[model samples]
Target chain A: MSYLTLSITLIFVIIPLILSKTFKLGLERDTIIAAVRSIIQLLAVGYVLQFVFNAENAVYIVLMLLLMIGAATQNARKKGASIKGITWKLIVTFLFIEILTQSILLGLDITPPTAQYVIPISGMVIGNSMVLGILFLNRFTAEMETRQNQTELILSLGGTPKQAVHTQLITSIKASTIPTIESQKTIGLVQLPGMMSGQIIAGADPVQAVLFQLLILFLLLTTAVTTSIMLGYLSYPTLFNQRMQFLRESLIRE
Target chain B: MTKAAIEFKDVDYTANGIHILKRITGFFPKGKITTLVGPSGAGKSSLFKLCNGLQTANSGQIYINNKLIEQYAPTVLRRTVGIALQEATMINGSVEKNLALPLTLKGEKLHKELAIELLKVVGLKESYMSRNTQELSGGQRQKLSIARTLVNKPQVLLLDEITSYLTVYPSRTSKN
Candidate 1:
C-alpha cells in the first residue's frame, strides 16, 4: 500500500477515538498511544526486514530470529511471573518450536530457504507458540493454585510429583490447545486468516494462498501441543522443590 | 510409649512471612490417635503438612518411621503418612474414581471390594460408591475423603478438622 493509503488508515483509529469520546470511556489516550506505538513498531520492523532481505546472510537471519524469540519470551513471561525462571522456560519452548518448524519447512523443501519466506514464517511460528506458552502457564498455575489441596492430598497419598500434577498438567494442556484446535476447525468459514488475506492482496493465487495457510494451520497444531507439554513438564518441577514438597509460595500471585 | 510414627525436631514453618510453627519438637505415637488442639490459625494444619512431606520445614528435620522425612522418596513417604484436608475437595467424578486415585498412582488395580470396606469404615454406605461426589452432602464428602485416604493404607492418618463435618464423633461411626 502507498503512504497515502496508509495515512488514510488513520480514519480507522478515529472511529475508536470518537467512540471513546462519545461514551466518555476515557480510552482516547490509550487508543492514540496504541495507534502511535503500532505505527512506530511496524515501521521499525519494516526497515529491519528490508535490510535483512537485502543482506540474506545466514548469521543475520539467525540473529533476527533470536531477537524475535527473545522479545516474545519477555512478553509471554508476564503471564507466568509467579513461577521462578519462567522467562528461561519460555525461551527454551519458543526456540524449540522455531527450530522444529523451520527445520521441517526447509528440510522438506516445502518452503525455500529465503529471507522472505523464512523470516515471516518463523515470526508466525514463534508468535503463536509464545501465545500457547502463555496460555499453558496461566492455566497450569491457576490449576495448581485452585487445586493446591488436591495436589497435596495426592502427595500425601503416596503420589509422586508427577502423579500429583498429572491431572492439572493434562487439564492445562487441553485448555491451552482448545482455542487453536477450535479456531482451525472453522478457519475458512469463520475467518480468512491474515497470511492468506495478505498473500491474496499481494496478487498471489487464492488457491496457493489457501494451501500455504493450511500448512501454517498444521504447524500451529503441532506448536500448540508441543509448547504446552514442554512448558508443562519444565514448569511443574519449579512448583516443587528437591524434597518433592509443593512450594506453596509459588502459587501466591504477585 | 511406643516409638513415634512421626517426629518433628525443632521444626520451624513460615507461611506468608508469618511464623506458624516455631521450633516445634514433638512426636505422634504409632497406632494411636494424637490430637493437635489449637485455635483457628494456630498452625495445626501446617504441622500436619510437615509430617507428610507436603510442606518442608523451614529450619528443622522431620522423621517418619525412624527415617528422615527427606530421605524417603516423597511418593513412598506419602504412602505411609496420609492427610485429609478440612474442605474434603472431591475430584470431578464418581466416588469410585476418587477412591481409586491413590491406587491408580501406584499402578495397582482398583479394588472395588476394598473400597466398599473402607467406605463402611468411614461411615459411608457401599451404595455411595457409584454416586457422583458432587451430589454428596458436606458431611458425606468429608467421610469420602477419609475413606479415600484409607485406601492407600497409610500407617499414620492425619485428620484436619475432619470431625467438624460429622454430626457425631467419627470414632462412633467408623468401624475400623
Candidate 2:
C-alpha cells in the first residue's frame, strides 16, 4: 500500500474514534485502550501468522483456529452474563460455520487447505462470524429480556415462540448481515477490500484477485447469515419458557 | 369468576439445588389485575415464571385452563400468556417495523393504521411511528412496549416492575 493509502486508512479509523469522543459516547480513555489493544493484538497475530503460513503445518493451523474460537466463546459468555451451558451455544455456532465453509472450499479444490489457505481464511471467517454472532446473541437476549411482556403477549395471543420473538430475531439477524450487504454494494467503487489488496500486493493478477475477493465475500455473507440465524434460534429459547414468558432467571445476571 | 387462568399446585422450584419456591398452591383468576407482591428474593418472580410456563415445578403441577402447563406447547402457552418485564428494549429498526412484528410473523398485513393508532393510544403521536425505537426515552419506550403487547389483546399480561419507568399518573394509567 502507498503512504497515501495508509494515511487515508489511519485517518478513517482515527476520525471515528475522535468523533465518538467528541460526541461524548465514551471517554478518551476508552479510545486509547481500544487503539492500543487493536494495535498490539494485530501486530502479534501478524507475526505469529507469518510463521504459521510459511510452516504450512495443518495441526498448527487447527490449533490456532481453536484458540480463536475459544477466545471468542469466552467473550460471548462474559457478555451474556455467564449463564451455564451458554458457551457451548457460541462454540457450536462458530465451529459449525467455520468447519462447514472450510470443508466446502477444500472439497471444491478452491484452495489447498494448507496453512496459507487455512490461517488467513479461517481467521477472517472465524473473527468476522464471531463478531456477528456476539452482536446477534447479545442484542437478541437483551431484546427478549426487555420486551418479555410483549413477547409473552404475542404467545398468549396465540402466537408461537418463534412468532413472539420474531422481531428481535429478525433484528439480530439483520444487524449481522447489513455490513456485509453494504460492503457488497460498494465493492470496488468505494474501496478494494483487504483480501483483494493482499492478493494484489503478493503479485497476483488484479482480475483474479477481484474474483477471489468476491468468493471470500460471498462466503462471509453466507457464514454470517447462517450463523446468526442458527444462533438466534438456539439462544432465544433459553430466554423464554414453554408457557411463553421470559424466564426471570434467564433475564437476571448469574 | 371464570375458570382460573392459571393454577399453581404444590409447586416446588429449585435452581442450582436452591429451592426458590416451595410447595406453593395458588389460583390466578382470569381478567383482573393481580400483582404478585413480596419482599426481595421471596420468589414472587419465580412464581410468575411458573404461571407463564417459563419454569417447571420440580415436584408439582401447574395448570393453565385446567391443562397441565408442562403438557402445553411453549408457542401455544406464549400466545396465551402475554408477559413484560422492567427492562423495555427497543429493537434495531423503525417503530413501524417493531409494531408489525406479530402480524408479520403470522404473514398478516402490516396494519399501518392500527400501528399508528396504538402509538397514539400509548400517548405517542403518529410521528414516532417512523422513529427509531432506540432513540425514545425510557417512559416512551415502556409505553410503546405496553402498546406492543396490547396489539394482539393477550388473555393474561405478566408485568414485572414495568411501572418503574413511568410517572405516577402513567403508572396508574398503565394498570387501567
CAPRI tier for the interface of model 1: medium
Candidate 1 recovers a fraction of native contacts equal to 0.96
TM-scores of the candidates in the order shown: 0.94, 0.61
User: Please, what are the lDDT tens digits per residue for candidate 2 over residues B39-59?
Assistant: 878887677666666556788
Give the clash total for candidate 1: 1
Model 2 has an lDDT value of 0.75
- Per residue, candidate 1 scores C-alpha lDDT tens digits across B1-176 of 33989887899998889999899887888777778889999999888888877777789888888888878887777778887888898888999999998888888877778988888888888888899999998889888888888887888888889888787766856536
lDDT over C-alpha atoms for residue B101 of model 2 = 62
Q: Which candidate should be chosen as best, given lDDT against the real structure?
A: 1
Off by over 4 Å in 1: B173-175
Off by over 4 Å in 2: A1-43, A79-84, A242-244, B1-176
Best by TM-score: 1
How good is the docking of model 2, as DockQ?
0.28
